[model samples]
Target: MTRGLVEDEKKEEETEKKAKKAAPAKPRKKATKKPAPKKRPDLEAHPTPEKEEKAPPKTEKSAETPPKIEKKPEEKPLEYKNDIVEVSVYHKPGCRIEMQIKASQDMVKEAHKKAIRTVSKQVNFPGFRKGKAPPEMILKNHPRDVDKSWQQVIADVAFKEAQSLAKVSLLD
Candidate 1:
């Protein structure tokens, strides 16, 4: 019984091996070639037709209606005087002689003399009594009085003239 069973196992293994070897193999397919693409034309190679720039259509009503105009009120000219202030000098030492006078050189000199005479009569100097000293003596002996009187008189005249100038500036 054992020998017959071993002989049956050997027959089963041989039948499996024969079945595997008896099966037919599949055939391989040949590769196909692809078609080439056609050439494309360049746009720059052929010139395009020049197109006319079409403007937007305008209405007749818009042409008849003119743009609103603005009229500004005329400005008044800045009131100015031709009175040229040719200030040859702005500031100087108290002892220095500097002025702005419209009169002639001789007239201005004469005016200075008159001013000195007038001021000397008004100021009280030390000694030699009051309002009695000559212009020369007052200028030499009482130099302080001479300087003060001269400044005061000139200032008074200048102040009167400046009043008009100040008014013009304020009004303008």
Candidate 2:
């Protein structure tokens, strides 16, 4: 019985080795070329020649001349400050808070300024003194920081309002 068991084990090991050898190795995938992009119609070839000709020309200006920067009109703040934040709370097995914040341009601008000031204090930018640079310039240097700050401010405001508006404890 012992001899028969030893022979069976040896046969199983041989079979496994044979099976591995019989199986073919997977071939690597060849890189395929992407299709060329479609050509767009030229502006000069468009049918609206009269509209293009009517536009004013600054063709004589040198390459070094800075482009005219147009200041966007500032949006007026909401008449009712209370209406700025609308919070919705769902009370079920688990509490869910949903908030829609309507921020005027002025509010966003203020948040950006605050974020810029905070970032500038921590980080040193070239050519400008620390925390003394313009808000717009500082914002350009640390866009992610400004965005995060604004989002944090908005979320804090929303959560505070939601808690009061819902009147139900969210943690419970």
Candidate 3:
């Protein structure tokens, strides 16, 4: 029985080896790349000239006819006016405008008073409630704040007045 088992194992091994040898190998395909596209000629850079045919000469009647005249409509200039701030607007090319503004002396004085009041409201002073401090004290202590407030007030008023006069919407 042991000899019969050994002989069967040897026969299986021999069959596997013969099967491997009998199988043929398949051929492999080569990898290929697509061709590049051709470039188009630049006609604008080097334009080709073609022969143009000459037109028949104009008749005497066609030459005697007067050319038509076209009339253009008149355009009105833009106008701007303001009481507090004087605005001079210059219309430039490409739909743009330039403005020069000058605030009146009265406007400046009013702006200064308003700025002092605004600063006094925001800051507290000794023996005084918030927003009830004297303008003199606020001016003496917070000159820089007063100046900034004054400029802001003047700019706001001038911009609003200028926008209305010019009839143009402005961004803040």
Candidate 4:
């Protein structure tokens, strides 16, 4: 699960950078190919007297082979074909989402354990000692299963923060 996303993120970033035109340097334009340089007139081979100087120097062949220039096709604008959803920010009282979201999801889980203990001390569990389970252990047992549980608590805190702001009319 973790491995897959790491690789995916690289590709995603590359596409995003290209789409946003955030590349460090723009792509260089490609060059066209040109015909190979011709043999210099002075460097042309002088044949020995034995063979009567090879057929008048093959001049017709070089003349027939006109110099050619080749250029690569221009690239199109960088297009991000991937789907990107839009998002909006709504100001609400007692919303602590910004501050709350700052903490890692794990921190929320820790807070939940703390809350659970706080609640459990005043209440009782069937077989366990009162508040015996450490927040860490309770969390370990639940493990990654409570993935969104942290977010819910954070959202709740954010709502409370937002509401607090609203109470003071800050959001107004």
Best by TM-score: 3
The regions of model 2 sitting more than 4 angstroms off are 1-81, 94-107, 127-129, 168-172
Candidate 2 matches the true fold with a TM-score of 0.40
- In the range 51-95, model 3's lDDT, one tens digit per residue, is 898987999977899767786653444556556877877676687
Superposed Cα deviation of residue 41, candidate 3 (Å): 20
Q: List the residue pairs that clash in candidate 1.
A: none
Better of 2 and 4 by lDDT: 2
lDDT: worst 10-residue window of model 2: 75-84
Candidate achieving higher TM-score, 2 or 3 = 3
Highest lDDT against the true fold, candidate: 3
TM-score of each: 0.29, 0.40, 0.51, 0.27
Clash pairs (backbone) in predicted model 2: none
Q: For candidate 2, lDDT tens digit of each residue in 11-91?
A: 999999999999998999999999997677663465754554565655767456888899866444222234444443332
List the candidate 1 regions with Cα displacement exceeding 4 Å. 1-111, 122-130, 165-172
Indicate whether candidate 1 or candidate 4 has the larger lDDT.
1
